[model samples]
Target: MAGFDLVVRGGTVITASDRGRYDIGVQDGRIAALGLDLEPGTREIDAESLWVLPGGIDSHVHLDQPQPPGIVQADDFLTGTRAAAAGGNTTVMPFVAQIKGESLRQAVTAYHAKAAGKCYVDVSFHLIISDPTATVLGQELPALVHDGYTSFKVFMTYDDLVLNDRELLEVMEVARREQALMMVHAEGYDSIKFLTERLERSGKTAPYFHAESRPDIVEREATHRAISHGELLDTPLMIVHVSSRAAMEQIRWAQARGLKVYAETCPQYIALTAKDLEGLNMEGARYVCSPPPRDEDSQKAIWEGIEQGVFSTFSSDHAPYFYEGSEGKQNPKARTSFRWVPNGIPGVQTRLPILFSEGVSKGRISPETFVALTSTNHARMYGLYPRKGTIAIGADADLALWDPLREETITQSKMLHGSDYTPYEGMRVKGWPVTTIVRGQVVFADGELKGEPGFGQHLARELSPYAKPGRPS
Candidate 1:
């Protein structure tokens, strides 16, 4: 009789270390051992001709965000987590948004109610500090940090979301004291507003003009400003959704100086560009995110940034907005006004496959490096290590079996995200996840969800690299 409950064989196990064909034995929901020809198990899986990797951990998804015009997000916890499972992600960290003028604790409490007992895999949250008053900065922030809400994001562009330098400083101080990581949506608010007024005055109100309203310089300036603020306060900062070569250069330059500046890029910047929205189809509104995609040279820079070790983490930043609904981007209320459109695309379900097709299949990045960005590095950076992001002894048995030979065409009809369309429709992907295991239970297998809806758990963080040492907010 085999000594283990499950054994996976005939696959190339890609870990942060060496890569070779190895068999992994699992017992009691932990990776008990890894060797060859020594043991048998109660269950066996043939991973022949496949790439086995740690299931992904996406740290930037919005499950039920409250947006401008009082619009609510289309995806709830159940739907978003299901999509994550199908995409081979066993863990996700979505945002718990703070409404303007509301107490931070209340907002988190409300979001907790939404995520509690309603997941397919393990889940966590990064607080969105939209209402950081003096009371919030002094009282609510530090307690929450100690309570395990270690990382948080702030916006620097939206009229409602933008925080001035003083506000930014106060927030950074909290992070510095709490030892939490601070993430910034870098973009010059005044510059964008000025450009918006100018464009509208000139009758440039079409969807294509949205990119023109906020050019590369605006994002570059904000990226630098955010880094400088972090430097002034001695706090580490991460620039999120970087879309231009110039913006990325600022991060690289700051990091070169030994400043704790980090950056992350999305598929939009790497795969799409302004030309994609040039025809001005009403549907183009769907692609109207901040720091719009840039030209081919910028795309090349993003591609090289990945291969050259620039970014430390990869995330979906997935914010789901429906099509043709009242708040959807497709049916614009203000035909020529770029500000009325939704600002994100549904990407949590496609980020992995896209990376596999472009990075691994093309050999731009080694498979191990891909694992690092998608799983290991995130866990290390965000305080979720060992328990959530690995396939090692004492780690959660969260694994994904990827078939390198299973080719497929991307389409919205087959995806599990709540969006009506797919941004990477028809793109050919050479590999796909054939099975996923979360905490010793099979959640997805052979294109089916085997886990129940409420099998997931809420993760409380103790300390974060992004948080200030001992301060709570």
Candidate 2:
């Protein structure tokens, strides 16, 4: 018999804090050894001239979400996880949204049904607490946290989902007491609503107005408010999808004061701008998303945040919606008003490639920082650390082999997502992941999928060390 189940040889293994040319030995889906030379195995892969990095962990994605009547999400667990795998992601975390009048447990059960036996990569869940009732906060939420649903998100905007200040405080108290991480979508709802109504009445209803209605000040103010709430409650909070320099400054201020205010920024903030929402007719609807992309100055600020460590994890926030379908971006009412347009773009399959080409290939960041932002930090923040986000012995053997010189012009036809279009279509990127392995199994290689839907498993997470209240400064 061979000495090991598998061996990957001759690749420059890159981790968040280390890099070296090494061979890896795998046994029973876990890394058994890493050294200059490993014992011969039953299977061997020659990884010469490639960069072997930890598989990405996209901790924020939307798959098979509950939508309004005329709106529909494009990808379910099968297609979403497949796209994630193609992009070199071995794990993804999508939301289980609790609707008003429903129990949080019920929402989780329903989401599990949707994801059962249909994923191509491992999955975890975050709870969207839309209805924080007495039972939820006093009982259900704590129980769920103990049961491994250790993080939950709350909205400060969206009319149907927003929580009042008292409600927000109640939720944060639970998070602090239970040591569960709290994530906030920080956009001022009343301010946006005020501007949106005025714009609609003035007939400024184009998709471009979507950006105008929710300007940087709204995000800035809401971010500051959220940070203050976390401070008051002595809780750690993560502000999601920050898109403006002003908002980033707020987070920096909190951090300087020794507050645990983590921040996240998506690819849209770096690659696109308000101008993308000005496409002629209804075409611009494709770029519509909450806290819409801002000006070039804002883009520069986002890049600075990444470099300066103001941002914690870089996520895709992939919310897939088709452009032409009636139930997607082009819903009948959406054509008439920006408010009705589905608020997202597809990017699960392109998130890492964009960062690799733009950030690492251009020397804006080193390969080590790339691994930290795309993989390691997410694992640390979401409680999956050494097990899923590194190449250490006894960890899951999840890896992505990259061709640092490969160039490709992105196109929807070349993508594996279920969406009809990609917002980054025609954009050129210099580096790409040529092979992806999950749990010691080669799942994607040479532009083909080698894994099946049921190969992915659901993960139960531990309470994140980074999220514990009163953590060291």
Candidate 3:
């Protein structure tokens, strides 16, 4: 018998652009071959009829950061990656943020310490420039990019994190020079703040008001401004959590102009809506998030954007905040006033199955498109391509075996995220990961995590293609 580390037999292998039934052989933490069965191996897993694809890459997540008073994320690197693996994702890229008055280098160092050896799978970081000083804009940023910290998010919304036009230009110039990607949280801070104060005075103190305060106009306007800024800087940009039709139009308009503007839509944008927050009592607080989910009409626009290829990738935006639990804001029940309620939901453990059921089962997207949005595109845009998001010979042996026939009603308690409530609670989903492999090792299987907590590695990523600013050769 030929010696191999492991053999995944009887799987219908698939990638972002192709599919076939094959037996994949893995050895020394890499794919040795993926074709017909030719030899035996140490471990053989029967994946007959299952969807064996590249492990998902969740490009947007906030693993651990002190979001400060009223909102602390529940999952650290340990629990976050566990839930990610449970959801069939073998790689995740989270932000390492620099708060105002903090050093960029120091902040990155601190984040690495918090995440080291605690992750459940391979992970990387995208830095956030909350304070773009000269040192950060010059030496530190360039050095970090070369060291594999190639992408960063710059906010245009929150007072503590938002950057003005001048500041944004400076940040963009640095990103352009370093060939790094910039992801923006595009919401007009001044406009949204004006609406928030106005709504409070108008006696609209309900969870639903959170959506109204920063209506689609706010998101669209900021999307336009961010795209324009990138154009002026000749850099590429990605607008995260685009939740409305108007915002999609802005990105579409920019792309039509031949701008490298990318968009990402989350599961919340497709699965939930403003009506979810209309529920009575404190129950509605669960649906609250920054740039809140729009109504059913906007949901349709998001779905259309997916089919039409407006969104280059998909992510969980997995910002966990416990609802009525020890890890949550003290007053999780308070529905009104954005300050009192935390802005996030636990979905890292449920993103894939929801998309598979709603998109694939409904024929809105092909299984190949699913892999593209969930894996390949993410790796390509984020500079992790061919290594973490494909089924090639040299890439990491990260795989997700999906059982399409499986059925289950998702509940917060059933997931491993630290949150006590899921906005998706009671929703039924089909198709989920029966097994997840990282470095040829099965970490999630038979409804349980089969490995220890410290098996994950912190990946260093080169500058992303989108982050590399350019107009042409």
**Top-scoring candidate (TM-score):** 2
Worst 10 residues of 1 by lDDT: 464-473
Q: What is the TM-score of each candidate against the true structure?
A: 0.95, 0.99, 0.97
Clashes of 1: 20
Candidate 2 lDDT over residue span 300-400, tens digit each: 99999999999989999999999997999989998788998989999999999999999999999999999999999999999998899999999999999
Tell me the lDDT of model 1 at 30: 80
How many collisions per candidate? Answer: 20, 0, 2
**Candidate 3 lDDT over residue span 411-431, tens digit each:** 876798877777888999888
lDDT of 1: 0.83
Displacement of residue 244 (Cα, Å) in model 2 is 0.9
The lDDT values for all models are 0.83, 0.93, 0.86
Clashing pairs in 2: none
Judge candidate 1 at residue 334 and give its lDDT.
43
What is the full ranking by TM-score, best candidate first?
A: 2, 3, 1
List candidate 1 segments past 4 Å from native. Answer: 331-336, 465-473
Q: Candidate 2: global Cα-lDDT?
A: 0.93
